[model samples]
Each structure stands twice: as C-alpha cells, then as structure tokens.
Target chain A: MIGVFRQWLAGLPAYLWGGWGAIASLLLLLAGWEFASQWLDPLALPDPRTVLATLHGLLTEGEAWAELAITGRRALTGFALSLGVGSALGMLAGLSMTASMMARPWVTVLVGTPPIGWLVLAMLWFGASDGTPVFTVFVACFPPIFIGAMQGVRTLDGQLREMAQAFALPPLQRLFDLYLPHVLSYLFPAWITALGVSWKVVVMAELLATADGVGAALAVTRSQLDTAGTLAWIVAVVGALLAVEYLLLEPVKREVERWRTLA
Target chain B: MAHIGVTAPALELAGVGHAYGARTVLSGIDLHLPAGRIHALVGPSGCGKTTLLHLVAGLLPLQDGAIRNGFARSACMFQQPRLLPWKSALDNIALGLKARGVPRAARHAQARDQARRFGLDDTALGQYPQQLSGGMQSRVALARALVLAPDLLLLDEAFSALDVGLKAELYRQLLAEQARRPMAVLMITHDLMEAVRLAHAVWVMAPEPGRIATHFRFDDAPAQRSDAQVYARTAGLLDDATVRASFGLDAPAPAAPLALAAVGGLRC
Candidate 1:
C-alpha cells in the first residue's frame, strides 16, 4: 500500500510538487487572516472564507467576466505596443553608441517618473476611454524592455560578429539568426517585468480614468463599503497576471531557451 | 578526385601592411600563392600572422599595399570552430552556400554530401555544435569551409587546439579535399613542424611591425613526406641562426617562452 502511494506521489506533475510549499504558506496566511478577522471589525478585514465566497460569487456573475476580458485586452494591447516600440528603439541604441547616448536622458526621465504620474497625464490626454489605460500601461512598461534589449545587443559576442563578417552573411540573416537569438537571453527577463507592470498600470488606470473593468468594479465596491468584494477583485487581477505569465510568457520563454540546455 | 584546372596565381600580396591608429601591426609583406598549393605562415605571437591571413581573406581592408585575389571564392576557418551554437552541423555547413545565393534545398543537400566527405555521419550532422565533441566541431567547421568549394582556403591556426590524433586525421582530410580540387591554402601556425608537414612553402615572420623574415620551399609533396624527412628539415631550420633569431630563440628568453610543438609527420 505504501509503495503504491509512493508511486502515485512520484508520478505527480513536478509543478504540483513544487507548488506545495507555496500552498502551505498560503494556508498559514489564510489562518492568520481568519484569526485577525475574529479579533477585528469584520467590515475592516474580512475573513478568508468571506473573501473566497465573494470571489465565488464574482466568478458566477457574467459582468465580472466581461470586466476581466476588458481589462485583459487593455493590458495585452499596451504590453504589445511597448514590446514593439521599445525593442525597435533599443536595437537602434544597441547598434550605435551615439544613439545610446542620445536615448539615455529620455529613458532616465521615463523610468524616474512614477507610473501614477503617467496615469494622470494619460487620463488627461486620452480621457476616460480604453486608450487611457493602454497608454498608462505602455508608459509604465516600455523603459525596462528598452534597457534590457539594449544591454543584450551591446554585450553580444564580438567573435560571433567577426565570424559573421568572415562568412559574408547578408545583413538580414545576421540580424535574425545571430543577433535575435542572442538578444533573447537578455530580452526575456525584461519582458516578464514589463508584463507585470502592464497589468498593474492597466488596473490603476481603469480605477482612475475609466468606468469599466475590474479596477472600476473595485472602486464601486470601495464606495459601497463592500471590503470582501474589493479583495475579490484584487484576487482576480493577480490571478489574471499569473495566468498570462504562466500560459503565455513562460511557455514561450521555455521554448526559445530550449537550446540552452544542449549547450 | 577530379581536378578543376586553375591557371592564375590564387593570391598575390605586394608590400602589404596594416596599422591600428598609430601602431603598425604588419609592414612590407610580399607573398604569392599559386593555385593548388598549401602555404604556411609561421611566427611567434604578435607577429601579424593572423593579420596577414585576414588581409588575404579580405576581412581587413588594404591599408598600405595591394592584394590581388584571382580565386573565384574564398573561405576562412578560424582557430575556434566558430560554428553557430544554435545551428545543427548540416545547417552551419549550408550557411556558406546560402550566402552565395544557393537555394535552401540544394544547399542542405550539398552540405550533407560535404559532411559525408569529412567523415561526419548523419547523427553528427544533425547535432548542434555544443552537442558535439571538440574534434567533431572542428570537422564540422572544416566541412563548412570546404562546402563552399572556394578556390582559396585561409586557415588561421585552425587545428592548433586539437589533440595529435584528431589533428592528423583532419590533416589527411584537408589534403584529400585539396586533391579533389585545385584550391590554394594559406595556414598560420606557431609550430614549425606543422608548417613543414602541411605547406609547399613556409614563410617565417618577425614581430614589432611584422614582416616576412625568411621563405623556404620544399620539393617533397607534403602529404607524402616521411617522419625522418620532416624531422630532418625541422632540425635543419632550427639549427640555422637566421631562422632561430626570427623566432626569438637567439635572444635572452622572455618571461614566457613561446609554446611551439613539433607534430612529427602526416601519418594518414
């Protein structure tokens, strides 16, 4: 019987085993929260059970799904725009020292200015439309991606460049085959950071500038003094971020880096 | 082996020189490589041997002299294999043909055929450079160079890193390939014996604004030379005061002695 149980445990997916520690930590946090709720006002700090029930209720409602979809679209659109524009500009900077020097001040300014500042400007410029949230996300996420890609290109092996020249490979082939794959090692980490920022900025923008999406729903829950509902929306936002990271970003990163293990 | 008749001198260098900013690396170099011969450049480090190879291969611009290349195509094999880590051996070999505007299918087929000629089997051809052993990587690199069917082949200390057995096997492969075509080869090496074993003519170079110190031509075909003959020639060259001085052996030894080894002869 013990041997059969061991076999079943061993056969479990690695991620399931890996996540057990996180699961244990989460249970401990929930227990602490439950204890705190019993000691404090229920309205101020809802118990884990109450928050979970609120999340279940929100999941069943069609409005919650629509809001999630809207927020997801905004975040993704903004992230995509940032990736395209940032990588292009980053490559240009990487290729030319003069360009890198010119770009430094602009990158510093953008990075130094908080995401809230961009959110305020976006809300004023783009108004309470979908554009405001997307613009905010773009403004928040572009700098990291740009910096990562630039460093990647700058640090590419000089020997490989010499080899490419010796072979007289076409410019396009060199860019695609030699440069792109090498740059990806630097690019992937920045992309993950950008993705996280995109979700956060989009939600914040929605709460401040728009009348729809999870952030707007959270604002409504706050005004109504529904603490459980507010926590449920926070949980939903975090869940969406993790879902995109695991299902989209991580898989693509793993596929691209599969060659590394061989090396 | 089929010979493609090449009539003109494969490469001609006249008063070739190079400098970086204020520092001159090579100066007043003159050499001629006729078709269907292997020429070797022997020198200590910082003697501009690699710089001259680059100049001949057209990787470096002519700064102070004229280099006339009569060859239709030229290929270089560097000291390191320099194979794309991401690419399979077949793909790496096919890259040269692809650069010359060969179609994908034809280049791949040609690469596979060339791989077989280098004794790289189907399994090795399918593997990436990082997946292969050091010797296998070198074989793939040699295959990549020869697949171009270049009229002139430039090797910049290409076999210096390999063990003795692997080096000998590659030497035979290189000779056999040359026999199939009338390609002229220019190799750079620190080893005098290696130069003697592989080269029809060996040029000894001097350092500090590098220039050719001496040139020696051998009557014996490199692939056919016996161990005794190679050792005798090497011993004869080493005994000469001019050759020894050019190699910096006559002077008080520097902090680090130049590591030069004699690979006895071509066994294969």
Candidate 2:
C-alpha cells in the first residue's frame, strides 16, 4: 500500500506541491485567527475550531445543504439564461457593424449599473419572489459574456476565413466547424468570470429580497450574533465556486485548446 | 484518370486586365493552358501572376478580359499552408470534400488514403498543423489540394518555404501524381530552376501593367533534362536584353553562368 501511495505521489508532483502549499497557508491563517480570538470576546471573533464545529453541525442538520441548493439553483438558472442570450446577441453584434454600434450603448449601461441597484429594482418589480435573485444574477453576469463573444468573433484570424472561402465551405459548416471553436477561446474566460459574479450577486439579492438560500441563512446568523456560523457559510460559498470553476470550466477549456503547442 | 472531354483546352485567358481602384496592375494579358501541360509563370515582384491565377480560379471578378476553364473543379495551394488550426491533418485534407457535400465517412477514408500517398504516416495524419514540421505541413496542404482530383491545379509559390531536399521530394511526388492522372498545372514562382525542373513551358512576365514578355517551351520531358541543360537554358533566358531590363539587371551577362540564387530576387 505504501509503494502504491509513493507511485501515485510521484505521478502528480505538481498537484502534490500545490496541495501542500495550500494546506500550509490555511493552517497559518487559522492560527492567526485563533490568536486574534483570544484577545476578543467569543461572540465578536470566534476561534477557527469553533467555526469548524459550527460548520460540522450545520452540515449534519441538513438546513445548510437546502439553503445551498436553493442558492445554487438560482445562480445556475440565471447563468444559463444569460450565457445563451448574451452569446447570441454578441454574435449578431460581431457580424453586423450596425448591430455592434446599436449594442454599444446598452452594453455600457448594463455594465455600469451596480448589482445592488438592479437587486432593488428587481425587488420592486417582482417583490419577494425568487425572480429577484435570478434577475440580479443575470444582470450582473451578462455583460462580460457578451463582450467576450463579440471580441472572439471580431478577432478571428482573417487567413482562416480566406481558406474557408477558397474552399467554398457552406455557411453552416463554417459556423460549426470553424467559427465555434475559434470563439470558444474567448468565451471560456468570460464564462468563468460570469459564473463567479453570478454566485455573489444571487446571494446579495437573496439577502435583501427573500428568506431562502445561504444569504438568508447568513442574515439569521447575523441577527443571532453567531459570527462563526456566518464565516462557515462564507467558506461554503467559496468552496462551491471553486468546485464549479476547477471541475467544469477548466477541463473544457483545456480540451478545446489541446491543439496549441508551446513552440 | 477521368477525362471530362478531350477537345477543350484546360484553361484560356483573353485580354485579361485588372486594376486596383485607378491603378492598373495587369493589362492585355492573354494566355492558354492546354490539357495535361505544366506551365510556369516567372516574373519580378508585384507582377500580376497571382492575380491572374485568382481570376482563373474565380476568386476575383474579371475587370477587363475573359477567363474560360473547361474543368469542373479546380484546387489551389498557397505559399503558406492555410490549414485550419483546430483540425487534424486528415480533417484539414477532408475539408474540401466535405464542402463539396461528400459524406463524412467516405471523405475521411479518401483523406487517409491521400495522406499515405503524400508520404505522411498515420502518426503525422493525427497531428495538428502546429504540431507538425514545416515540411510536413506543406505535405498536408498538397494532400488537401490533390484530394479534390482537380483537372486544373494552381500553385502560388507553394514550395518556396521548404528546404531544397524537401522541395525536390515534393516535386517528384507532384510529377508522379501528374503522370498517374494528367492535370493542367499553372505555377507562379521566382525560382528559375524550379520552373525549368517542373514546367513544360515557362512564361516570363514583366511589371508595370503586368503582361507576358515572352514564352519558352521545352521539347524534352522535365525528368529527362540534365542540370547542365537546365543551367544552359536558364542562362539563355537571362541573356535576353528585354528579360534583363525587366528584372532591372541591366549589367552585361556575368562571365560565370547565372546561379539560381543570383536571380532569386527577380521572382514574383
């Protein structure tokens, strides 16, 4: 078993190094938090152990998981809707100069408007319903994805287009086989950015507009003066964000770009 | 091996002239390519050789004259191997067939067979264009062109980027393919030796409203010509006062026969 473990470790030296470094940093941070907690009241700044225990209790009780699921669903719904609509519009803008000119003002307005302002407007429009959080997430995430798709289409290599024309490829074949792959290079990074913003915006909307999801739970913890529980909820949100990015987005990006060589 | 018809010339040009805005690039150009003949166009830079090829390939609209092509399909290989970076070598080769509405399985099978004939092994066929060497990329490009089974093949300095050994090998492969299935080839080159080595006839083009200055036809097959004979012919062509004046090489003929490198800059 030790021999097998050693071989496994040897096979992934880079991951091993990164994992050890992360563990060391986390331990150092926890120690600093522990030291700080000793100087303050337990209610003001809870120790790392207390926060860990609170997290463990929350996990076992299952309420935290339900809140997490609600938040995740809202964020994902908003993200999927925005990605589909934003990419379609972006492609239209990229292809037609008139469309691009018309879209510039709207995109600028959407990007400039703060998420809190949209959350307030959504609350006014949809009241206390789940639509508030979903709308907030979509508004916050759409701009980056739109801009990325537009730039991607605009910056495609001219030589490749010429080649396609010279070969007389049909329009649909060029779109699927040439344009899609090239556009993905720009679209992937925008997707990751949109996803992170979606999570944050969804929680903020939930905190203000509804008594559901992690944001609402954090509100309850704040009212009860349970600082450690609030910290635990924050940690859970971060963990979920990292999981989506690393597990889903990164693998797809690597697969799409596998044709590239360092040389 | 499939002949559409025997009587028609492969390609014909009459009074072809092109202008970019108000500036004329070519004028009064007349040329004809008979079936199964390899013709080379050699000229100084900025001559309309490439423009003429594009016109015949239907990439550019005719400005002055007319172009007639009897071939149902034509293929061109550019100076650079314009392979789609996202595609594997086999997929790049199959692209034209795919565009022509060939079924996926059959085109891929044909592409694989064509790849093997171009001296590309299975390993090379599976690689992306960037993953392969320059010579290998050229081979893929050539394979991509040939897979169409074109009746007219257009090459625009296609082998200029390759080293001598690779270029010679590709020349041999091209000649072998031509022998098996006869096709009219119109190649534009700055390399005189390459023109002599491959072309049955060579046309010398002059600039400033680019037009053919003269033409020379070789009676002997390209494979039968010796280096001495090639050099002698090259020297004879370079000796012409008009050819020298067009190239801006007005000096009296050098005591030593002109080497290929000496005339490299004169190529279009």
Candidate 3:
C-alpha cells in the first residue's frame, strides 16, 4: 500500500499539472483581457464577468437553447447532405478519369468562389429562409469530403487490390475490407475539416438569410443595441459546437481508431 | 498414407521468356515444382528469379512461354510483408479468408490459431503492422499466407529482413508446416546456405536474359542442413565460374568481334 502510494505521489506532477495546463493558460488570458478592458475603453471590451453574467441571463431565459437547436439542425442537415453527395460524386470522379475531368473545373470554381456570393445566390433561389443557410452549409462542407474520398480512391495500393483480385473477393467485401480500410487515413482528416467548415457556413448563412438560429439571434440583439446579449449568443454557439464535437464526434472517432492502435 | 503416384506438379514453366521494351528479363526458362517439395531458385542480382516467381503466381503475363499449374490456390510473401497498416496482426492474417467470403467467426478462429502457432501472443495479435517490429510483421505476413492453405506458396526473400537466429527458427517452422500440409513452395533467395537449408532442389539462374543455369538435387545429401558439407557445396555452386560468366564476367574475348555467335552471349 505504501509502495503504491509512493508511486502515485511520484506521478503527481503529471496528474495534477498536465491536464490543467491548457485551462490555466486560458484563464490567465481571460483575466488579462478583463484587466485590460477595465483599464481601457470598457464600452469597446466587455469584462469576463460581464460576459458570464450575460451568458447566465441568456441561459435562464432559455433563449440560448432555441437558438442552439435551430443552428444545430441547419448544421447537421447541410453537413449530412454534403457528406452523402460528396462521397458518391467523389467515388465516381476518383474511379473514372472522364468523371474527374468533368467535375474538376466546376469544383475548383465552387471552392474558389467566396461564401458571400453563394449566400446571395442561395437567398435569391430560396427566398430568405432555412434553405439558403442549409445550401451555404452544404456548399462549404462538400469540398473537403469530396477531396478526401477522391484522394482515398486515387491513392489506393495496387498490390493489395491485386491480392483481393487473386482471392476473388466479392465487390462488397472488397469495398469494406480493402477499400474502406485503405481510405480511412484520408477520410478522417477530411471529415474533421468538413465539420468545422459546416458550422461556420451555417452561422454565416443564418445571419444573412434566416430570422431564426444563433446568427439571427445575434443580429436581433445587435439591432436592439444589446451588445452583451450578442456576445452571449456568440459564446453559446461556440460552447455548443465544442460540446457536440466532444460528446458525439470525438467518441465515435476514438472508437473507430481503437482497432487501428491494436492492429 | 499419402499417395505419391497421385501427386501433381504444383507449378510448371516451359520456355518462359519476358522482356520490357527491348530489355529481356527471362528467356527459355523451363522449370517444374513437384507437389510438396521446396524448390530454391538462387541467382545473382537482376537475374529474373523474382520474375519467374511472379509468372508462376500468375501476377505477370508470359510473353514467350507458358506455365501450367495444378494448385487451386496460391499466395505471395513479398520482400516486405505488405500488411495493411489499418489492420491488426490478427485481422491482417484473416484478411485473405475474409476476402474469400469466409464467415467472420470461423475466419477469426482460424487466424487466431495460426497466429498462436506462429508464436504471436494476444498482445501482438491486437497490434497494427506499423506498430510491429520488422521481424514481427514478417511473421504476421507468413501467418497470413499459411492460414489460407495455399497449395503453391511463392516467397521472394521472405526471411531476408530477419536476423540469422530468427531466420533459422522460421525456416524450421516452415519446413514443419510444409511437411504437414505437403504444399509446394518456390523460395527465391540470395542466401546460399538458406537455399541448402530448406530446399529439396536448388536452381541457379544465369543473368542477361536469365535462364536456368544449373539445377542441384540435394536429396543425396542430409536433409538436416546444419552440416558443414552442405554449406561448402552450396557455396561452391554460388561461386561457380559458369554462373559468373552469365553475369558478363571472366569470359574469354572472341577472336573476331564481328561474329553473331560471340555477340549473342551479350544479347538481352
């Protein structure tokens, strides 16, 4: 018992300090900002406590939850549609030179063109509602996922594929065992990239086109001259996004990768 | 009892020749791998030994000749293990069966059994190929090949990356496994002693559009090849002057350089 306790004590530095290091740094930055804002123009920079109080007010009134739900729905719907369409098109483009040639110029144009342009077009097409924001999210999310799937197919090992041919693996088995395993390294990074872009696009589109969601709520607060409320909504959006990533995507990613470490 | 009369040649190559553009790699290469026997194809660098192995495995097309085979199944163990990086050692081993439509439960059990036989513990079994040391990865690749019950196994320097002791151990296990299954193996190696150690017959390939330089049946010699005599004999063959001549070395110059016959020796 003494030996175990001694061992535990020896590991105390890592346990006590390692995990909290980032949090400590963040706290230090927040405190510095609070101090600087108080000393300088308080009108321009809100203190951390003021932000917290605004956050509390928004939470108590249940406004944050409704805004969160709207934004969340738009983000998920657009992201899912992007993933589905992008993966299918990416597969075709990657597998066939003709398809790739046909899609490349247009995809390049789409990727290069700014979101503001697409939002304008989407609003014109969809008449200033959820469709516009969702379309913007879809447009932002598709490129990364498409590039990932295409690259995954393009860079597949010929040797392993030949091995599958010799073994006479059925097409479905080949996809799951050979293709999917080979593609995951490329796919994971792409998915993570798409996740971030999806949220940003959804918020931007919401602000421009919709009268609901977090971005719309921020606009409303701004119109009412409630700067504190606007900041609170912005904080809520970021917090909710982080929570979704930590709770859903991260656990799924960890589970998917566990076999990789073992293997 | 195993029926000797009913046994078939696992692989047969006749007048096999291949060329890339104008540079020929193989020419008039005739060979046969009798069922259950280990055949060693030894050659100097760039001598089309690997080409022959590939041909027999049906990986490359025959340009000048044909190879007949009785084996229903074959597997190749490359110079590198060529394991899937995303798969665990156990899963990689089971991949061949999985691809062949074997049920998950049965395939895993068979793979696990082979893994244990190949001396991979559960911890090792769970690890990915990238996480494994070079030697461990090769063992996992070997386990993958053996689990499939391949009638013809084409090995291209499978044990080259391993240490001397590990090579010897794997060689023993391979010999034992071959005995049990009566599967034919064509192993390409630069190690002369390794050739003598495991093969029933050794064929030395000559370079420059390589052909069968010579064949040695070591059946008259002891099967257990730790003997000094076996090493001496194999070393002698490895260093033979004719084998050297094939590599454009130590050949007498022609009296007249214009003749087709003299230049034909240098022809690719």
What TM-score would chain A of each candidate receive against the reference chain A? Answer: 0.89, 0.87, 0.85
Q: Give the TM-score ranking, best first.
A: 1, 2, 3
1 against 2, candidate with superior DockQ: 1
Evaluate residue A235 in candidate 3 and report its C-alpha lDDT on the 0 to 100 scale: 76
Give TM-scores for every candidate, taking all chains together and pairing residue i with residue i: 0.90, 0.87, 0.83
Q: After superposition, how far is residue B181 of candidate 2 from its true place, in Å?
A: 0.8
Pairs in steric clash, model 1:
none
Best by DockQ: 1
Misplaced by over 4 Å in model 2 are A1-32, A35-41, A96-106, A261-263, B1-9, B251-268
Which structure is stronger by DockQ: 2 or 3? 2
The number of clashing residue pairs in model 2 is: 1
Worst 10 residues of 3 chain A by lDDT: A246-255
DockQ comparisons of all candidates to the true complex: 0.49, 0.43, 0.35
Candidate 3 accuracy as TM-score: 0.83
**TM-score pick, better of 1 and 2:** 1
Best by lDDT: 1
Can you tell me the CAPRI class of model 2? acceptable
Residue-level lDDT of model 2, residues B1-268, one tens digit each, is 2233557656778889999999899998877888788999988888888888888777888989777788777898999999988899999999999999999999999999989998899988888899899999999999999999988899998998899999988998888888888888999998877888888888888999899987777756776667777776787667766677667687655576554334322322
* lDDT (C-alpha) at residue B144 in model 3: 89
